[model samples]
Target: MSDPNTADCDSNLHASYYADGMQQVETELVENEQIAQSTYRLRVAAPTIAARAVPGQFVMIRLAGVNAPLIGRALAIYDIVNNDQGDPTWVDLVYLQKGAFTTPCSQSPVGTPVSLWGPLGNGFDPRPCDRLIMAVGGIGQTPMLLLGREANGAQAFGRPNGWAKDVELIYGARNEGLLAGVDDFRQAGFDVQLCTDDGSAGQQALVPAILEQRLQEIGDTASVRVVTCGPEIMMEKVAECCQKHHVDCQVSMETPMACGIGICFSCVAKVKQADGNWDYKRTCVEGPIFDAGKIDWS
Candidate 1:
């Protein structure tokens, strides 16, 4: 497969890839509403960034002039909202307010000046498949919505048409209050399946077990593909289940990042080479999205 990070991060809104020349803009926060328990959906006016963003991509954001936390926080590009003229105007990000950056960010009033950069990292591959299963846990569902929209023909990103015959989301959270955007996924035509650890949502089972059951029901492994994000342990289990069923799987790594660009090695992930040796690859540039089989999950 070709390197997904080589695409131009310019004004080519419909391009299949984006990279290197990502824009850093001084934009103002439009809205920051709490969508779920401790989860806030932040909207920022970043036309240039939003115009080039694809599903599974992320942005580094910080409150302009805030020095207590000097480094920007990496947040997934959840969705893009267009204006009446059909021009991409703002980008939305959903985040759990648990950390230093996020807690303060959530408290910032609307219209606060925000500085953000991106359309960074390699996004999920929009290739066609018979069935696309999104295995998610915690706040991992943030990036899956746009992917689902593209896959179900409701929106277009890199490709012009919907690529999957069907899309199902197996989302798991601690409880019902943490299950953000379930209705949004359903609205986008995904077969929504829910699971929670505390039995406060759809099923009491884990996400990987639910994924395994779905894989078994599908039977035809070649036609199925799985993409997972969330806790590493959960993703590891999802990857294992996909491998056991001979199904192709992709993972969106949530490695801690300092810079959205590849200059900092802070977001490196272990990737397996063809020669059987594993090397560190920068998640910011090489991927946030990687083939599950190529990852050295150890």
Candidate 2:
């Protein structure tokens, strides 16, 4: 078993790295458009953040000088937009418009002053793999687009790009209208397979079932990596699927956070240690992304 003290030290070091790499910025919205049912894509002109951000990282956002919603909301970096010269200029965030913060954010017009900070948390490993399977549910598909583009050689993120020969996305939502950004994934060269609970779109099935079928089709699990986000239960099932297949899996936890930074312990998740014991790890710092096997789904 791993030493719990050693793990704490590592987590502290990781938190320091996050602190050093992040900066707060007061920017303005470039675009905020409704993409799907109750889903909206907000684009912000955060050049510094956009240039530094990689796939799977997220930002904390709030209306500038807003006192009503005291804390910022954490949103994943959906996709980074660039200028004609290929210079990163803005970042896009996709959000479900049900929450208190989101409801207001959706109504905010373009050019609204926004405050945010990030490029925070460890992102998915950009290492090349033979096949990459993205298992996502609900709005979890937000972070997969950029990763897919990087994996397919269409875009480069933090490191050198294009290692996977095949990239597929198995995404599930409550219904067809809620499957946001379907075309975006398709355009990024991902073989997109979609499912819905209500049978409103694609197959009337769950994401994990489709993932299992795809894993069976792939045969060899060695060079495969599965990354998942969205509802915790869904992620747990996806992790279970990966474990059963003996394939590597990474999970983006959706723990609630009062502070997007590591200060608050509100977003801590129980994580297994090398020693076989479990300890709390801050989702905003140590994760938001972690090994599937290490997470204590119980």
Candidate 3:
């Protein structure tokens, strides 16, 4: 039995749309010491998507057909940006160079025509909370940008939710060089924590370590509700840490997707349902955002 109301909410509140594949006319390389990741901010040139796209979502990208034919690449919606010409010009599909396909796609210089379809996946539920903590690991921090935007969204010209006083972000990378875009979030007024594994810059530890340290600094474990996205180990560690401290946590899980839609179960994740039975949820549809406790990372 399905609840008609919930189904309506999913249809109305959580809707999906197709964004046309556009050429990457521009590529800005964000280089740091630990990793050399290039970001390709695709110019969608389509106004419809720009107006409706939400945060914590992703797009399926088809690499330029150069040599061999391959399936499309799915990239997180790093930013929910607007077009240059203003109101309706389009959206930007930012890609973090991470794999073989991404590597070639990275080399394809500006003006390379590629296929893209998205604004896919279920994003975070950005309702009001007493306080919010966002934690990111590696390139996984990309989606945090959108979460920041959502937190700062206005229904018209004023803060719709009237979000409360505290907002924090914990970011991780190998060295100072790998910690790119920390400044952007900071400029947006997030209490940003930078951590590295090699003691290069910021805090000398992993993100989970810094997060725990921060929680200790605050000393109020129960007030923090976390939103996290990162490596499996980092998320698991963070989740465990929060639980140990009695903090409520929400995590964004990233799994490989075949269709970038519900048709393919490749991106399915095990979730503990209300009935106490575990069910598999497609990350493309059911969620990328879920309560940390409901997930059995084991």
Please count the clashing residue pairs in each candidate, in the order shown: 0, 4, 3
Model 3 TM-score relative to the real fold: 0.81
Q: Model 1 reaches what TM-score against the true structure?
A: 0.93
Native-to-model Cα distance after best TM-score fit, residue 228 in candidate 1, in Å: 0.5
In angstroms, the error of model 2 at 169 is 0.4
TM-score versus the correct structure, for each prediction = 0.93, 0.94, 0.81
- The lDDT for every candidate, in the order shown, is 0.86, 0.86, 0.65
In the range 1-298, model 1's lDDT, one tens digit per residue, is 2233443222122224335548999988889999999999999888898888888899999989879789988899999999899998889999999988899888989989989999898889887898889999999999999998888788876455588889999999999999998888998889999999999889999999999898888877798889999999999999999999998899999888999787767987888776777777777877889889888899
Model 3: ten consecutive residues of lowest lDDT: 25-34
How big is the RMSD of model 3?
5.3
Tens digits of per-residue lDDT, candidate 3, 167-272, equal: 7889988777777677767877788888888878778888888888888987976666788888988999999988888888888888888777667668877776
Question: What global local distance difference test value does model 2 have?
Answer: 0.86
